[model samples]
Target: MSTHTPGEDVPVRRIDRILAFMSLGLLVLSIVCFFAIMIGSASGADMSGGVWPLIGVVVYIAPIVAFALMLAVLIMSFVRRARANRGG
Candidate 1:
């Protein structure tokens, strides 16, 4: 026999929900910064006002992807919790 706790996988009761939300917010922040950096890069050259390829790209790519992942998991947890609560 297997035993389980109530709201074990539930988003409302899980810490991941908070983490996911935080991740999403941070990702959004990164995105905003990314555009700014990219525009700044576009304007000039490295030695003469160019964008830093490594830093700018990382700024854009990492947060967006991370936030998506976090949001996905958070949603899943919430749905799972709702389903369990409903005895579905």
Candidate 2:
């Protein structure tokens, strides 16, 4: 790492922050939904109506989208680091 002071660090790109936050939000949502489903099942609550189907869809889809977003963030981060190193 460079010896730059805290106030002089490399700036994070706006898109990178957005992608990272999106990934984090989706991941948290999926985990919450997964646990909700588990608790609902364990308590023998009805799983056939209301928010169950929506929760099920979120459980299935959120992780995949989160993973994709994380991958994108990683790629962008790497690219930015590489460019910085090369130019410096």
Candidate 3:
């Protein structure tokens, strides 16, 4: 007989939620920046003032940051499940 309820769902940890959101947000930001750069280049728009530099950096950096955050989330989740299965 199973001790757990079939309909029960595990609650997400606060850190897990925050990490997931941050990772997703960064991924989206990187994609938008990438498209903006592509369109700007295709249209020969001046891309050297105001927020352009910041956007360029984001296009390169955001995906890396997001990947790292996602890796962290995965590791934490693995540890949590391991502990739970161990009856900790």
Over 7-52, each residue of candidate 2 has an lDDT whose tens digit, in order, gives 4335788998999899899999999999999999999989999999
lDDT of each: 0.68, 0.88, 0.88
Superposition error at 41 for model 2 (Å): 1.2
TM-score of 2: 0.78
TM-score of each: 0.46, 0.78, 0.83
Evaluate model 3: give its TM-score.
0.83
Residue 45 miss distance in model 3 (angstroms): 1.7
Candidate 1 C-alpha lDDT tens digits along 1-88: 4476673644354566667676777777677767777677688646234445655666767786776778777687767777787778
Ranking of candidates on TM-score, top first: 3, 2, 1
Clashes of each: 5, 0, 0
Deviation in angstroms for 86 in model 2? 2.8
Tens-place lDDT per residue, model 3, 1-88, is: 7796434445689999999999999999999999999998899888988788999999989999999999999999887776666667
The per-residue C-alpha lDDT of model 3 at residue 72 equals 99
